[model samples]
Target: MADIEFPSVEWFQALADITKEDPTYRKFGRLNAVIVFKCGDKHISTNFDVLNIHEIREVGENARRDADFVIEMEPDVWRGMLDDIKKNGHASLDWTLNTLDLRFDEPIHRNELQDGFKADMFFRYNPSLQAFFDNAAKIPTKFVAPVA
Candidate 1:
């Protein structure tokens, strides 16, 4: 169990460690994309390539760049997902990563070419990502204090 916060280098490292051991993740046919997460003033970015996660970088501020996906949310929403992951061995219907992103009314950023390709990866390797996050159930987390 880990006491890491969401959108932190430690959190990303923990996820990467879990994913490395997942056979399902290995079957994903090599994913190479950058995912950026933003919440209030916190920003974290990670690069995944060849099914290997690398470069878990913490940035002081959001920068303009092309990414496969850019997830922006309130810190509380992010904490809820982590708590759900801890409880259910996976995110629940309302907390699923994709679902959470869709629930946001504003437009999210994604590079059409890269993101479109990643969408294919999602369909092709849905189970793997599911399994990857499912491993979160084994990790302990502290929910971030919600900002008003």
Candidate 2:
């Protein structure tokens, strides 16, 4: 509701909070994974319970090792994407997660997926993953120079 800083737990919390009241977020299939958004050194995770975002918090760097997968991006890249979302009410074609993931040489990483099952969630729920970031457009976010 306020101007929350991007890449922080509060910002992701705001996004997760918005999805609770909006039916569009739940209309998609379940996003059953602990999705981590890593900006620079900040690691913020959103745990999805079926189609709902069950939790949002900042975790240590080891989050990548424990998470099903992590979406890692440079601070400038994140700023560009979020800025576009804010200006257009959603990410433009070029800024969408899939497009940018490829454009940046696959910023989405599958860490410690020993059984190979965990990695599938990223692709299986790719659309929902995209929607989740698109949902961030609904939050009031402010960007500043990254700390690390």
Candidate 3:
């Protein structure tokens, strides 16, 4: 297991590698879009197009992009989700990705597609995403400095 930090290139690469091998991920079809992960003052933007998952690019101090989703949360929350993945091979109640994002005090950005068609991708291909993160269960993770 790899000790990964949120907003780090290594973490995103790990997820990409895992997703590529997951059968469920292939079922999700091709997805092309970028997702920005922001925690406190640190920001990392990752691009996922087709089956390619790029490294996390530091975009500190830059304006946000027009992305499919913008996932923002406290550093501790991110660590908790990874910890949950490590324990259960999947995120549970308090650490479910969607649940965490929804519970965040700040706004979570998503495409304005009608009826949340864009957001539905998470549900439609949940098994794949779950499998992707489940790989984390096998890897060691290092906690980043938490925000208050």
Which has the greatest lDDT? 2
lDDT of 2 at 7: 75
Residue 123, candidate 3: Cα error in Å is: 6.3
Q: How many residue pairs clash in each candidate?
A: 0, 0, 4
TM-score of every prediction relative to native: 0.76, 0.89, 0.74
User: RMSD for each model, in Å, please?
Assistant: 3.4, 1.8, 3.5
Residue 140's lDDT within candidate 2 is 76
Model 3's alpha-carbon lDDT is 0.65
Candidate 2, 1-148: lDDT as tens digits: 5688887888887777777666666777566788778888788988988867866888888766778777777899898898888788888998987788678655455655553688667777887777777887778778867777
Model 3: how large is the Cα RMSD against the reference? 3.5
- Candidate lDDT (C-alpha), each: 0.66, 0.77, 0.65
TM-score of 1: 0.76
Candidate 2 regions with alpha-carbon error over 4 angstroms: 112-116
Candidate 3 shows a clash count of: 4
Model 1 has an lDDT value of 0.66
lDDT of 1 at 27: 68
